[model samples]
Target: MSVRDPNPLDSRHPKRVAIVLSSPAISTTTGWPVGFWWSELTHPWLAFRERGYEVVLYSPAGGRCEADSLSDPRDPSRYSDTDLISLGFLSTPKLAALVEATRPVSELSVDGFDAIVVAGGQAPMFTFEKATELQRLFVAFFEAGKVAAALCHGVALLRYARLSSGEALVKGRTVTGFANIEEDFADQAVWEMGALTRGTHLMPWRIEDEMRALGANYVQAGLWRDFAVRDGNLITGQQNFSGAATARLVIEALGG
Candidate 1:
């Protein structure tokens, strides 16, 4: 219910963070291309970087990862047109290279990083729930008393990850992710796009629905607000707009 190990992590020369991202995938409900969200990844990365934390981008299978087109600042949709952070990140070759070819999440170990943050996007709704390997890695960090965090639908991993005692990591804990209100809006947007879809539900599962099913005390701010809750070392953001706020919580927990 609070910081697991509050001792400052600054003893190390600039902390290291392992940010796991969802790789490319197709949406089952809408038959649209899906990947990580640009703002979710960039905002958090900047928060950590500005704190002098070394961050590494990793994918489940390793290789180039793509961002959901609508989340892209350069997209014609203008959904994220004002996202200068992602625009700056993508335009700069060196910083952009981070997500270009990510190392495999399987190669990661708690020994190499101070914290882990799973970014969310369209792909996560389809890929993260059944990602046992990602669940294991995330649980590893948490069990080791390290800072473990996730944003948006990426928090889906918590629904299945269990502690050594076989209890769900989120059981009876306080958390937040993409809320049902936000999901409803997303569903409407997809329907408005006239995608060849059978239903208005744009996702296989909703983050709020799943987390609540797991018995977590799911809390949230207004839709699209910068809300993040830190139940000890496990931190979660409300939605894409909450990325930097979530990362700041991690930074706070780490005493960065």
Candidate 2:
């Protein structure tokens, strides 16, 4: 009798997921204190925890993860009022502990996880682009046929993720993320005093532009819609609102 090896891509095993957060911690183009968004991080976390998947949080440079000021309940902006998932997450001491001791991606091996999710924030545009390590990690996962997901500004990585063949990871995949029009509207909003600052224009090229440039299938649902797309094993969400749905898509793709 011959013993066969287990197929790692098979979703029967308990999934070990690693989620990457921002480190340089600055807004995309505005220079504001950057961190993960409330719903973007918590909703997906809740979805994963509910499915009994083990979750690990990592930052590019490692350290405590910060929540964007706009997402803070104590902030007057109240930008995330409709996000109940974040509200509950912020209220829980145990759940709050994750941000306090998040491991740096430098200390972990992406290959050990079944899948990896790159969570977003206003800061991802700044931190993610320069994160060569993260780019490499994502490419490795993509080549290995593992599930890879990103939301909002986190999708910026697709611009830099090159495959072993020197092709972009999103070259032919359909995906979505924070839209340029939303950025324009956000900049015009009270968040900024109409200075047309750097962080205010960080998104630069919309997901549609960059994805289309690479010949990748790109779509934008709306300004702030809960839209997510799954291309093969790769999953992507439009914005913060799509976090939960994106996570569910990830689980479903894994055959849960």
- At residue 198, candidate 2 shows an lDDT of 36
Error of 1 at 238 (Å): 0.7
- Inter-residue clash pairs, candidate 2: 29-198, 29-199, 30-199
* Residue range 8-113, candidate 1, lDDT tens digits: 4453688899999998999887787889998989998888877778999898988889998988899998999999999999999998888889999889989999
Give a tens-digit lDDT track for model 2, residues 79-178: 6776777888888998888887888777768568988899887777777778898999888887888998998888988889999999888987899988
Any runs in candidate 1 off by more than 4 Å, and if so which? 1-12, 196-198
Candidate 2: residue 48 lDDT (0-100): 82
The C-alpha lDDT values of all candidates are: 0.88, 0.80
Clashes of each: 1, 3
**Model 2, residue 247: what's the lDDT?**
93
Model 1: lDDT to the true structure: 0.88
RMSD of each: 4.3, 5.3
Number of the predicted model whose lDDT against the real structure is largest:
1
Colliding residue pairs in candidate 1: 2-232
